[model samples]
Target: MNQPHHRPDPYTERPWLNPAISPFIQIQGVTKRFGDFTAVNAVDLAIYQGELFALLGGSGCGKTTLLRMLAGFETPTEGRIIIDGLDMTEVPPYERPVNMMFQSYALFPHMNVFNNIAYGLRRDGIKSDELKRRVNDIIDMVELNPLTHRRPHQLSGGQRQRVALARALVKQPKVLLLDEPLAALDKRLREQTQFELMNIQDQLGITFVVVTHDQEEAMTLATRIAVMGAGQFEQVGTPADIYENPQTRFIAGFIGSANLLSGTVQDCQPEKGTDDAPDTSRVQIVTDEGNQLLSVSTDRVVAAGDAVTLAIRPEKISVTLQDSAVSDTADKVPDNAPNTVSNNGSGTVPGYVSGNVPENVLWGTVQEMAYLGRLSTFRIKTDAGPTLEVTAPNQRRVLDNRHLIDWDDRVRLTFSSDSAVLLTR
Candidate 1:
């Protein structure tokens, strides 16, 4: 469970800008409202070209509304949107070089695959021969040559999705918008189609933006993700960046399962005998961690006595039984000072409590166990009052801990402070 404490300090500046790279699409203070309800708040965003980006959030979070604004289906009440150096504030959907694929796959049941792929071209008054050539090329690109003559009902769900994609790409727009493109397929087909979509996006080199509520799907498909909440972007970065370096509690909790512990900073010890003193902090988060608190880096104007939240991911934690092998023992606090020697382990750090195991372990009872073939998930209810979720992989059937961690059995969970993240809220 998380412990809470209080301190006095004004909130610092929020860091959401990434000015390291060139931006292809820019949105400044964009907002949308209807009646007395606001669907989208004032938000700033930057999206690069030739990138597969995802807007991820739960329903009513305005992800779909943001996408519709980009596609010109809805106009923003304030701010400006620039795509490929053109101001798109008032540009109509048809006039803009953008195409959107609806979530429903809105294909005509009466039209064959060829005609479906050529519908946009024919509506735009393209020449017959060129339209046929482009339609056939896209049909072959999607690997739908065998089903080119089949209507929407004649093909499988996956094939029909491909046909819809082919039609969307037939116009060769500068940017493509996909709205929950894989939400209709079954789990197995959706997994397979994700890879196919990546391959096609790379091969075509068109900028693609997908809106989804599925966290795993966004992590798998997007080069970068914008996690939305309350109609605003909480954080935007690559899948790894969003997972590892979340800027807020919302991002930390929304992106993955994180353990957020709130406390007051007791001390700030900088790295001694190092040139990088200003970049790191040896801050004590709470009255825990045995005076060897984790180091965190930030320029958020924090002092020794301040309120903050330390966020840590579940997988980063290491669990062991109480009687298991003892690892570290170097940091034995004597009186008021910390131990002089560092517990830098080659593989396993030396024990901290000298000859005894440290008191960092949390005792818990396994409340539930779910075996998912190669790995097992154990939900343990700790004495701290929060249920901790732990995933243990099953390598050797004989060595499986699943048998040891039965319901109501006592277990100990421990993890290093370095694996834990420190946050402000």
Candidate 2:
């Protein structure tokens, strides 16, 4: 079993270790409810200073409600919200040192670009000269100096979004909240604005909490992501951490596309042949073909005869049409001969699998193919059950590989045990 790598980096400290001194914003056991429905369940989270954090989920998942609670637009039913070492449980929206950029770009139609951005300062009774300096500095920062006199209707959608961002950051709040900041912009504009937002955050060194439903946007923008589901956070980690090492079945399926395989736990072995030895406290997974077993590497205790689910992302798996036999290079795979026959092996199923393959291969037929700009997607129908989604890179100016394997042509999908994760519930 491969040990779970939980050791912290020597240069930096882990956030959860020192919750008292680590967080610029802390939501401890926070819950929100309206009428009989609970929009947000009990959730505990912390956002460090000068970091970009993303709360990502689909609609009605309480991600919006959680953001509202942090912005002081909605009060929590239980628990406390502490920002910058100040308990804001009883703080009102206007009094708290927090600002939120709404999704709809709530700029007043009667107000021009300068007045709209200067509205917050004017309301706070700041003198005209200071307000002018602050507003001009922000206008220069957002590159809206040329469009100062333009109204909301006169500007493009992306320009209006920059105005809203300028207004949100003008207050110099310790925590800045953005609700779907780039949702209104076009695809190209959104992509450009992501880098702009990142640059602004780095320059100002302010903590940013953004809410986004776009997975790609979250992966790009967030230093750490809190993936929400059913009004609670499923997992909180870096985008790479969450995508590569999902802890649960729902997390594996939600974060990205994953292939889930169900099997029964067999005898545990350190290597391959030690299954019947005396030290057999660990659990092993067995496939249907024969005595094919995969060791469970997690620290979670499991017994023999337990049912387990293996989750593997499509990108971790590599597919080859012309396969004789390749060595299992990953240490995660058991070191032993094939006790079980591969469903896609050459002689076991004619024309379905390649010859003398490993036991981890599966047989499938290519039903459909789609050539995206950078990658080609394949919808393969596997005999094991469901339709598998596979991707191949387009390296050069070459035609599709349809001549080698066309519609209804069977193929093999081979992956190692390390690529697959054992999901225990």
Candidate 3:
């Protein structure tokens, strides 16, 4: 029996992609300045309901500042913040429909887990019965029932984190703001807790805004990520989108590992399409290494002679030992030999045996290698000046120390044109 394929519902699974739906949180022209420095420039963003959005960047990149503004801790110098169709720019932190869990957890040392979770409801003057009900319900949700009687001092780091999370969630705020929520846990526990946090967010269906400096954390936890740089947003998109199609060199280098090559546009061939469809151009780039590269560009315009950069992910590159038959002929090719386009529109290195090698291929020697359990990373120092990084999966277990490819061995690196990203900036 054949089952029908279930397509994703864009309205529920990805509201941002649907233009008809309104944003749940809108930051309009928001900026924050302190003394002589601008912590956050004029930034605008829209977050839909039930999104687990992440603000990702390094320290001093203004991710925290922007989050504080969202929490009403810092007033925006020049814009407005709207949450659920209400202006919250000037609203007090306590009055806003949001709860923030600090990085330190900030559990009350004198209180037990149950009391800590109930403190918010108590302070709000809820009835004793209702407070107990809410506290117990949240404790069960976070799976802290066994540790309900334990104080912060008696609980483990993960337990205390759950207590703080229950405390914040007991109030049932419309949005939850987490400041490096998993920073305090050990590596193994942090990875474990990431799924827990996501599960809690899913059960509650609350919009969660997380601020973190760790790229892997953001990429793992966020439904969408906003990469910050120098008090402004460098790029904003899904983790896959940000990783696969970074807009600039900064984003290309920041989001993940990228091998960047400076180049000049040699030619541009626009793809034929309907007038209403977006324009796409196949760009030919002559890199500084004298290797010609081809990439598809859809977002930016480029013409002949324009300077550009080609960004390639290490995982996209394949490494193979150079053919023994052409070893001597390959060595005869100059380091700076031009890659001329063959009749089939593929690149061929001058002085090398034609048809034996594919387009966008570079000859190099393995300078370094790292075996990372599931995959191996290689640093290949090309015959040209640059060293390119390539990663390949280890398909089978090796009982001996000998690897399929070893250090100091001559290798050829090749990647498809679609794997290379064209960055104009």
Candidate 4:
């Protein structure tokens, strides 16, 4: 028998995974303090070459402070900063091999787009011909050729952003530090510019370190993300790694919305495995409110009586009417109603009634509903004394409101055993 050849995934080409490859930028035990206030805690980080890394956090989370340190704007109160193979702890801002794009594009009002981009090259004493070639090449790369003569005041928000980017890139720095680069644009333009930024970064291959509070921006743009909280790194990994397997309760709630329920572990069933493979366990949890949930193939270890939290995303849940016979008076439905149901003749959610409820099922009443064109969000008041949010897509056009899953309807919620994450923190 012949072995099959495996094709590599482009997104999974992680240089950081190879231990022999040295880090392009390294921050070892870096910390910053202002009098009694500690802005950044002692944190260690490694950035690979040509990687688009993001420092993500909310207001006052030390992401900006760390970015400034990398740019040589602020010296660390403790620890060292290394770029390539040199220690740059005390290097001045202008002397470092990095360029920073401020949140406010920072284009000169008196200079047109061309002069704004050429300003840095002129200060470096480049000859006129070489300066013009570099500046025009960058301008063309950013698609700002026709607007080169326009001043900052005459350009729209998106065009001004391109000018700022062109100015930053013309100097040909080894690294680019962007402090909330896309924060000023409106929603649609911001989304569009994110792709443009990615394309330019791919073309240049310069290491980029971005600071942003927007989760979606970081997820869409970064090859890896470092989620910070209160002067410390909460977690650092690829977008999918951080989102799917959050290490803490704060991370589980911060990256996205999760229905967090407090519970106690009822038992654990650890499966046998080889030494090289990760150990797997099936955990049974009973909520404080008397609801039972099961998590399958979880990697976390927990014994009976250990307190834990079960996190389930809203989109992972499936909701359907309990029965077609159920009436306006939801309380009339039997407490021990059958866990399975027929279509009830309503076409709202077809094929949803064909299976029995999974181990992670809840009986609830639809308390609220919001139709937002593509999908509808529902807040279900579970009989277990918790309000669970469920989102369902509107697959077919709604011709009549009568057939829709309305408010106060008795509903059953089910999720796959693997969908629920077990968090012991």
Q: What is the C-alpha RMSD of each candidate to the true structure, in Å?
A: 9.3, 6.5, 4.1, 6.2
Ranking of all candidate structures by their lDDT, best first: 3, 4, 2, 1
Between prediction 1 and prediction 2, which has the larger lDDT? 2
Per-residue error (Å), model 3, residue 250 = 0.9
lDDT of 3 by residue, 1-425 (tens): 13325755656778999999999999999999998899999999999999999999999999999999988899999999999999999999988999889889989999888888888888789977888888899988889888888889999998888988989889998999999999889999999999999999999999999999889999999999999999999999999989999999999999889999998887787876556556677677767664545454454688889989999999998887766424634444443453444547445424223244433667788999999989999999877557899999988785687888889988777776667899988
**Local accuracy of candidate 4 as per-residue lDDT tens digits, 1-425:** 13324646443469888877899999999999989999999999999889999999999999999999999999999999999888999999888988889889989999999999999888789978998899989998999989989999999999998998889888988889999999999999999999999999999999999999999899999999999999999999999988888888888899888888888886788977666567778776766664444453489988989999988888889887877434532333365643232236232321122234355556889999988878889999987677899989988777766536779988877776568788887
Per-residue lDDT over 1-425 for candidate 1, one digit per residue giving the tens place of the 0 to 100 score? 02223532211111124344557788889999977778899989888777899999999999999999999999999889899989998999988888888898889999998888888898899978898899989988889998888889998888889988999899998889999999999999999999999998889988899999999999999988999998898888889888988889998899878877666675565543345334555455542333223334443446777978777676665554433423343333222232222445132222222124442445566889887767667787665445667777766573544464567776666655445667776
Off by over 4 Å in 2: 1-20, 270-284, 287-299, 323-359, 383-386, 400-406
lDDT of each: 0.75, 0.76, 0.85, 0.84
How does model 4 fare in lDDT?
A: 0.84
After TM-score superposition, the amount by which residue 100's alpha carbon in candidate 3 deviates from its true location, in angstroms, is 0.5
Clashes of 4: 0
C-alpha RMSD (angstroms) for model 4? 6.2
The Cα error of candidate 4 at residue 410, in Å, is: 1.3
> Weakest 10 consecutive residues, lDDT, candidate 2?
329-338
Candidate 1 residue spans exceeding 4 A from truth: 1-22, 272-278, 287-301, 326-360, 383-386, 398-404
lDDT of 4 at 20: 76
